[model samples]
Target: MMLTILAIDDSRTIREMLRETLRNAGFDVHVAVDGLDGLEKLHDIAPDVIITDINMPRLDGFGVIEAVRAGTSHAALPILVLTTESAPDLKERARKSGATGWIVKPFDDAKLVSAIKRIAAH
Candidate 1:
């Protein structure tokens, strides 16, 4: 089965890059402008994995993760945070919010794809 991905980022460049990269990697990629949009699209896409940015309008990555984990159906969905923030405390916070994985921005395409594959493997 083809894996579908939901990528949420406030940056147009990041969103476009994710769309191209994930699509080229043989995954169906759906994008949202921010955490709220991502949550809204969650039901529609029912994505296998989610890649999100930490700092955004409305809701942030942590909020998204918490929201997703709040529900039984999507509590275990794999969520990978892709952000420029590399602070240790932030990483710990993300983990606490139930993120499956984290990726620093300006990420290597191969590594990003690999992380997604690893998380989605379950």
Candidate 2:
């Protein structure tokens, strides 16, 4: 099956990069500019997996994770967070909010794809 993936990031460049990379890898990709927009898209279509960024204008990555986990329909959905913040405290908070995995910024395409496939496999 072609897995549908939702990628949320405030930076248009990162969003497009992820979308293209995943698409070339044979996955269906959808994108949102920020957390709030990502939430709206999540409600409209529950993708197999969600990849998000930590810093955003509307709702940050943690906020998205909280909202997704709080919703009965999406509570169990898998989420991989890609962010620049590598602090242990931030990762802990993300875990507390129910993030599935974390990858620091400037990630290699291969690693990112591997992580996505791993999470989507679940």
Candidate 3:
């Protein structure tokens, strides 16, 4: 079965772009505008991996990672926190919250896809 990826970011353009790119890469894609929305989507369907941004309305990437780690259904799921922030402290916090890795924003599709492939074992 194809891996399903849940990508949460505030930018509609970024979410759409990621959905299209991941779909083309042979993975199922789901989108959310922010961390709250991501959690809602998670209730509907559990994704193999979650890619998210750190800054957003309602809730941020850290909150998403925290919620996921606390949730019994999603605690074991892989997460990739994609954001503009490069701070070591933020990355460390995300790691503590259960993020598998980090990626900078405005990232290339190849780099993003490569990250997903590695996470999904594609």
Candidate 4:
């Protein structure tokens, strides 16, 4: 089965890039403008995995991770953080908040695809 993915990012450019990359890799891809939008879409789509950015207007990636982990239905869903920030502390914070994995921005298309497949497999 083709895996479904919800990709959240505040930047329109990033979202479009993600949509193109993941769709090219044979995944059903959905894009959300920010963390708030992502959470809303989460309920409607129930994607197999999520890719989100760290900084956003309404809500951030950390908030997205916490909200997803808080919900019983999506608590175990795989969440991958994709952002420009590569700070170790931020990564640790996301890890503690239940993110499945992390990817720095300007992400390698091949690696991003592989990471999603890896995390979703578990």
| Model 4 lDDT tens row, 1-122 | 89999999999999999999999999999999999999999999999999999999999999999999999999999999999999999999999999999999899999999999999999
Candidate 3, 21-92: lDDT as tens digits: 889988899999999999999978789899999999999999999999998977888899988899999989
Q: How many steric clashes does model 1 contain?
A: 0
Residues forming the 10-long window of minimal summed lDDT in candidate 2: 104-113
Determine the backbone clash count of candidate 2: 0
Q: Residue 77 in candidate 3 has what lDDT?
A: 84
Off by over 4 Å in 1: none
Superposition TM-score, candidate 1 onto the true structure:
0.98
lDDT of 2 by residue, 1-122 (tens): 88889999999989888888889989899999999999999978779999999999989999999999999999999999999899999999999999999998787888888888898788
Q: Name the candidate that leads on lDDT.
A: 4
- Backbone Cα, N, C clashes tallied per candidate: 0, 0, 0, 0
lDDT of 1 at 81: 96
Considering lDDT, which of the candidate structures 2 and 4 is the better prediction for this target? 4
Using all chains and alpha carbons, the TM-scores for the candidates as numbered come to 0.98, 0.96, 0.93, 0.99
Better-scoring candidate (TM-score), 1 or 3: 1
Candidate 3's C-alpha runs over 4 A off are none
- Give the TM-score ranking, best first: 4, 1, 2, 3
Give the clashing residue pairs of candidate 2, or none: none
**Model 3 alpha-carbon miss at residue 110, Å:** 1.8
Please give, for residues 40-90, the per-residue lDDT of candidate 1 as tens digits. Answer: 999998999999999999999999999999988889999999999999999
